[model samples]
Each structure stands twice: as C-alpha cells, then as structure tokens.
Target: MRPDPQETAPAKKQRRYWHRTDWLSLFSGLLFIGIGVRYLVEPPPNTGVMVLTLVFGLGFAGFFAVVSRAFRKR
Candidate 1:
C-alpha cells in the first residue's frame, strides 16, 4: 500500500513567541519621528548640532538597551 502524502511530508516548524521589543531600535525610531516633526515645525539652524545630537541620542539609547537587558529576567 502507498503511504499518504501528508504523512510523508516533513512537519512544519512553529515560530517561537517574541515577548520583548528591541528597546534600542524602538527609541531610535521615536527619535527619528520626533526629529522629523521638529524639522517640519522649526528647522535647526545648524546641521552640525543636529548631527551631534542624533549621535549622542543613539549612544544613550544603546546604553539604556544594554542596562535593560542586564536587568531583564532570563
């Protein structure tokens, strides 16, 4: 007798649940949104200052993410 096609096929892989959000990327996204709003309302006078702020803000977000991960329950 021939085996059933369904039985011969490999089992499908189930995806694991992702419970936590990526904090660093989340904060970075918010920062960009806020910056976009600010740009539309009142543009920054200096491009250099805006660039510096972005760099520092991302650094701070990264630090926060690391600290959060360190304290999170495994």
Candidate 2:
C-alpha cells in the first residue's frame, strides 16, 4: 500500500542550532579584529585592552575551528 502524498512529502528538516555557532564565532572574530586594529593604531594607556582583543580574536578562531570540525561529516 502507498502512503498518502501529504504524509510522504519529506518533512522539512529542522535547522540545528549548532549550525549557527560557526557564523557567530566568525562575527566575534571580526569584532575582535576590529578592536585589535584600533588598539594597534592607537595604543591604549592600559595594556589590558590590547591583551583582551588578542585573546578574544584567538579564542573566537579556536571556537570556529572546533565547531567546524564537529560538524564535518566523515
């Protein structure tokens, strides 16, 4: 017996939340890069701002890498 056409129509796949993680990470990285550039061009009185931007940029890059790896299908 065949199924009803309405029932058999492939269910639209639900989008995974993890799929957005990579894009979020990329955006975060870009934001940090902008801050880093600003600090590089106009050094802040406190060294912490520069350090923070470097950490933020690197951390986001690492996050993107890990998420990309996790989502990769063999």
- Compare the candidates by TM-score and give the number of the best one: 1
Tens digits of per-residue lDDT for model 1 on 1-74?
99998999999999999889789999999988988888999956588888988999899999999999988956
Off by over 4 Å in 1: 1-18
**C-alpha RMSD values across all candidates:** 3.8, 7.9
Candidate 2 achieves a global lDDT of 0.72
Q: For candidate 2, write residues 1-74 as lDDT tens digits.
A: 98899898989989876534456567676877787687689856477866776777677777877777777743
lDDT of each: 0.89, 0.72
Off by over 4 Å in 2: 1-40, 43-45
**Deviation in angstroms for 64 in model 2?**
0.8
Alpha-carbon shift of residue 42 in model 1 (angstroms): 1.0
